[model samples]
Each structure stands twice: as structure tokens, then as C-alpha cells.
Target: MDVSGAGGLTDDRVLLGRTSTAERVADILRTRIAEGYFPPGARLSEESIGGALGVSRNTLREAFRLLTHERLLVHELNRGVFVRVLAVGDVDDIYRTRRLVECAVVRGLGQPPFAVDGLAAAVAEGEAAARADDWTGVSTANIHFHRELVALAGSARTDELMRGVLAELRLAFHVVDDPHALHEPYLRRNREILDALRAGERASAERLLARYLDDSRTRVAAAYAQAVDDPAGSAG
Candidate 1:
């Protein structure tokens, strides 16, 4: 696939900086993975990607190795590299982590010294996407919403962790039968949570977020189960 237009890393200028060129390439690929440009199980064509990104074969290999270590990509002996497909357990684990972290963020939101600007902005973006009938855009904006939710904690470590969690969530989202069905209902819920947070209704917001995640977890897990059972019948 042509990733030159996606992944926020389209610049082809020679990579030269403190970090190795391979690491820079890996970052680009990671962004692509998170953005859903390269869906789960999509094969990475070294020649196409390397040439498109203006990188050498050696650098691409190194970048692939990095993503493999991050569990975003896998390498088979003769099959080359493909995006890692999450198992049902992986889906459950991701939600479990989110419940612990995100709910806590909402619980703490009403406390003094917090920022809801990011969260509000994410909601606006999602609403705009929904208005435009862009399911993918809604999905992207939803991911940003949760990422910003975690940022309310003002912890660098937590923000970094959510980045990985959100990326893995994208992998599972690719299997859902109806992106609109799965996401449209939740847009209103997101707005409700934001409103509660703004009103200092911490308890209400936390409850809303818990229910929201539980429903989403069930939906995505069920869809992933169906996809794993019959890949040919799965949705994209």
C-alpha cells in the first residue's frame, strides 16, 4: 500500500539526526499503524515501502525489527512481515487496562488543576466527522478523545501507555461489522461524559465512561471473535 500520503510522516528528506534513520522510519510506521492506514494482517512490502519512503533496505529491515519488538508487526521465516492481528484475549486485556486508567481520569477530572480543553476539542472533532458522515474520521477522533482523557492526569508515562493501548485498539476496530453502528451511538455518550466532567459531576462522568467502555469492549470482542472464526466473513 502507498503510505506516502498517510501516517503524518510523508517527508522524504534524508533522515539525519540524533536518532538513527531506522528509528525515525519505525516512528512513521508506528503512526501509520495507529492511524489504521495499514490494517491488521496487512503485509509490509519492503521494496514498495522503502522506495516510497526514500529509505534503504537495511533501514527498512531495522525499522521492521523495532515494530516487531513492539508487537505491532510480526516476521515469518518465509512470509516476510505483516501487521499483528490481536487475539480475543488481547482485546480483553486492552479494555481491562483502559477501565483502570480512563475511569480514574474521569474520577479525578473535577479536582482543581485539570485540563478539559483537549477532551472538549476531541469531542468537537468527532462531532464534525459524524456530520461529514466519515466513519473513519469519527473513529480517529474517538481515539483522540480517550488519549486526551488520559492526559488529564498530566502524567507523561500514562500518556505514553495510552498511545500503545489506542494503537492496539485500532487493530481490533478493523474487524467490526459496521463502523457507523459501533461508533455513532457512542458520540452522544462522549458528549454526555464531557458535559458531566465540565459540570464537576465526577461520579456521573465516571459512571458514564465505565458503561461506555464496557459496551465497546463487548462489541469489539464479539466482532474480533467472529473474524477469527471466519476471516473471509469479517468486516473491514
Candidate 2:
């Protein structure tokens, strides 16, 4: 019996091989952390997680280090790894930077001289994810859309900073109770923002994007406050 056709092997092992143990462990840990399977400040034990992922402690440690550098995990001397929680000031600074970066992207928008098909595709994906009630997918697509939006600024540094901001925002999303409520209404708003850009109304798009950012900040802060007040109620 050929194990190859049974999803066991392939002609190109390089292409069909399973992900590296470290990469797989990192991905699992990242997804769980993002999905709130492990709440902020939850300590992670290498031995237990290695057992769960069928990986060595070394591999799991590598994964932990990766996430720690990404700001998703925190490692302290004499203390093990724990999920990083965003402070109120961190959230405030995140939105302030987002407003500056994203508004600039919108302000630079104009008709068809640049290809925005990628942005359009990301918006479509986000809308579909929202409809499917896949909050994680919705959040991922939302980040992609805005990242592409900021990419229009033609600055690699801006793009890198935006990526970090988006990851921190994902942490905020996990902390909030009603994730859908925070993202659902923005589907139309994103479309409208794109429409304004396509119509060459750069100023209008900038205004709309600024307003959207403000509203999102308000919602996130309210949710964070509620989460703080009632810990058990806000399980992402």
C-alpha cells in the first residue's frame, strides 16, 4: 500500500513536509494566545506545552522566545513566560500612532494611479469573515487591509510600525468581550473609505478614516474598562 496517496508522502518532500517543530509550536502558541485560550498574564510552562504539542522543551522554548520578542509573550528573570497584557497607556499610544499612519494613507489616496486591488480583496475577505462570524479571521483580514492601506505611503518603516501596532491591537481585541460588535459595523465603513479613495476624494477618505479610528478607540476603551470591572464576563 502506498502511504504517499494516503496523505503520508509526496514527490517533493521539501514542498510537502510538515512544518518544523519550532514553527508549529510557535504557531499553535500564537493562535491560542490570540484567541484568548490563554488570557493575559497566564503563565506558560514549557514541559506542559511541550507535552501537549509533542515537541521538545528546546523547541517550545524557541517558540516562546519568538513570541516574547513579538510582544505577545513576556519573559522575566527568575520568572517564566506569561502572556503580555496591554496597559491603558499602551492602548492610547497605539491608537494615536494608528491615527497618524492610517489617516496619512487615506489622505494620499487618489484615483487608479496605484493598484488598490489588494486593499479591495482584503476588505472583501474581512466582510466574508465577518458574515461567517469568524472573529479571528475578521481581525486578521482587518489588519491586512489597514496594513495595505498604510503600504500606500511607500515607507517600509511605517509598514513595520503598523505591523506591531496591529499585533498589539489584536491583543486588545482578545481582551474585549464582544469582538464582533467591535468589527462588524466597520465592514461598511471600510467599503465607504475605499470608495472615497477610488473616487479621488482624498480629503473625504481621510476624514472618514479618522472618524472610524476614533470610534474604534472609543469602543475598545469601553470594552477594556468593562473587562477590567468584570473579569469573568469578558472572555474575548
Candidate 3:
């Protein structure tokens, strides 16, 4: 997957002209981290990774910095960068914030006249990914669908915060052994919520969304607890 030399570039330059090595490295590493290739509490060694990825230490360091800022990786003084460890409080905070933002969006569902097609498309993508057994893709699509759901409220700040919240929640998904079990059931529920919205059943949609979030929070928390107690049994 290294594209640095694919385009007949001279040793002095990289492919695509403008994409820096650091940026490319960051994207590759981020995708792997999100896909659960790097488990929580796992230590990342710069030199070894650089060698494996065919990059220099400098480029890898820059990539690490990007992930650290995204809160996907944490740097411990002198101990090196490790994937973040999520506590029970992290789970609570993530779900609490999601409920507040998502429910608010639900309450404002029909008042301002919002676009629901984007959410519908995202849900379709999630369904496809689920069918293909691409759990990471399913998680990514699901997050985007819900973010679109929150966008119905018409608040830019809420949108930004919800993205961060979802990113943190994805960490929990990595903790669970079966990503499908955690998210597959919700695909139909999401469709139901959207149906309520399309039918102008605002109150019903709100209620459905609330219950959906509650069930999701419980599943994620239980998975996290199981992972913590039996790390070997959990997914990456």
C-alpha cells in the first residue's frame, strides 16, 4: 500500500506531488487504529513501525502526533505512545453526551424542515458494510449516520462535539469482540426512527431514538467491562 514510489517519482520526491509523507503515514495509521489493528494499552514502537512501513522515524513521529491529537493514541512520558485505555467513566460520558445531543436533535426533528436523505444514505452504507462483515466500515458509517441525525438540530457546535464523542465511542467498539452484535440490531432501529421522522411522528421518533441510545449504551458498556476483565477474549 505504499504509494511513495508507485508513480515513478525520483528518490528525492514522493508520489501525488503534494501529499507529504507524514500525512500519508497519518492516514494509514489512523485507519488501522480505527480498524482495531492497534488494541487499547498496546505500545507503539516508532523504529519498528517505521521499518515496517518503509518510512523514516521522522515521518512516523508526525503520524503519531496526529493520532495523539485525535485522542486515538496517548503518549506517556518516557513510556511511549499507547492506544488509549477507556474506563467506565469514559463510557458513561460518551453515552451521556450522545443522548443529550441526539435527543435534542430528535426533539427538533420536524420543526425546522431538515434533510433526511443523507442519513438514509449513510444507513444504507452501514447495512452494506455489515453484510460484508466489514465491522470497521459499519462503525464508520453508523457514526456518520447519527451525526447527520444530530445535524437536524442546525447547530454547528453540536455537530463538532458529536463527531468527537463518536470517535471516542468507536474506541469502545474496538473493545467488544463482536462489532456486528453491538451495531447490527440498530440498523433496523435507525430505519424505524427515520420512518417516524418521514411520517411526521416527531414524538415517536424521539422516543425510539432515546430507547435506541439506551440499549446501545448498555451493550457498549457490557462489552467494555468484558474486555477489561478478559482482554484476550476481546477484539482488537
Candidate 4:
């Protein structure tokens, strides 16, 4: 699953055109990071990745710089860049932002008979992934559900913001010891929110989302802290 080279980067969406090569590299790298292809604290090897993707060092460096600016990667002098490992404070702030933006999106919804087909599909996707024991897929489906929920507002800027935020959130998830325990409980909450939205109960959906994010933030932060505290844990 090393998604580098012709096999990985040559997809229609990932094609590197003559222009925007660096931007395309950034996009590809960003997606890979979000997908947990590169987990938290994973060192990105410029030489191997650049060679695999047929990009120059300059292009790869620029892409890394872009991701670093996004707070997804950190640069350490004499140590190279690695994926960011979130602190407890970072977790709280991320969820606070989520509660603000996600709840606001629900509250801003227009009247009844909402267009929530995408949300419903995402919920089904999570269920299917759970049935298949694909926890990663479940996490992805959860992200999709929230993305679809935000789409209710129809704002490109907000969509872009959540894309980054959720990607960061995924970094925290990548460090958890019990993926099933961390993610399984939330699938039901996703369904409940989706049902509420479909029923045109915006306030109820927003409240559910607020509680969900708050609870998720607390759970994820505690798990991450425990991992960091336990030397044998995989926080690295």
C-alpha cells in the first residue's frame, strides 16, 4: 500500500500535470497523511518518496512545507520532519473548533425536508465497514458522515476548513490502542445524528453533535495521553 510511483500517484485525480506539480504533490501527500498511510510521528522520507513519485527534491520539500504550515507535520532541526503528535491541549482545541463549526452548520440549516441522503449513505457505510471489521474504513465513513453533515450549509470555505481539521483529528485516532473501542461507540451516535437531520430536527441534531464532539475530544485526549505516558505504547 505504498502509494507512491506510477501505481499510486498516476490515478486521474493524482496525475501531476505540467503546472501545479508542487501543489499536486502537496495534495497527494495531504491525502496520504489523512488516510493514515503516514501515521502520527512517522518520518517522511524525502528521498524515497520523491523518487517513488518521480518528483524532485525541491517539489517534495515544498509539499512538506505546505503540510508543515497546516500543522500536520513538524520540523525539527537536525532531526527532519515527522507527522504531528497532538498534545491534550491540541485535542481540546480541535474539538472546541469542531463544536463551534459543526453545531453552527446544523443550526444554520434551512427549513424541513433537508437534503441528507449523503449523510444516510455515510452512516450505512460505517455500519458496513464495522461489519467487515475494517476499523479504518469505519473511521473514514465517520469522517464522510460529518463532511456530509457540514455540506448542509453549502459553504466551500467551511468544507475546506473541516477537511484539514478532520485530517488532524485522524492523527489522534491513529495513536489509540483500542481502535474498535474508540470508534465503534461513535457509529451509533452518527446514526442518531443522521436520523435527527433527516427528520428535520436541526436543534436536536446540533445538540447531539455538540455532545458527540465533546465526548470524542475527551476520550481521544485521554487515550493519547495514556499512550504518551506508557513508554511501550505506540504514540510514536
Tens digit of per-residue lDDT, candidate 4, span 156-217? 89987887888888888887777888889899999999889888898998889999998988
TM-scores, each model vs. reference: 0.85, 0.72, 0.72, 0.88
Clashing residue pairs for model 1: none
Clashes of 3: 0
Best by TM-score: 4
CA lDDT of 7 in candidate 1? 35
Candidate 2 per-residue C-alpha lDDT over 92-201 given as tens digits, one digit per residue, 9 for 90 to 100 = 77899899889977666555555577779989999899878897678777877887899888888887677666766777777777777778878888888888777777
Let me know the TM-score candidate 1 reaches against the reference structure.
0.85
**Candidate 1: regions farther than 4 A off:** 1-24, 52-59, 232-236
Cα lDDT, model 3, residue 210: 94
lDDT by candidate, in order shown: 0.82, 0.72, 0.74, 0.82
- Residue 40 of model 2, lDDT score: 71
What's model 3's overall lDDT?
0.74
lDDT accuracy of residue 107 in candidate 2: 67
Whole-structure CA lDDT of model 2: 0.72
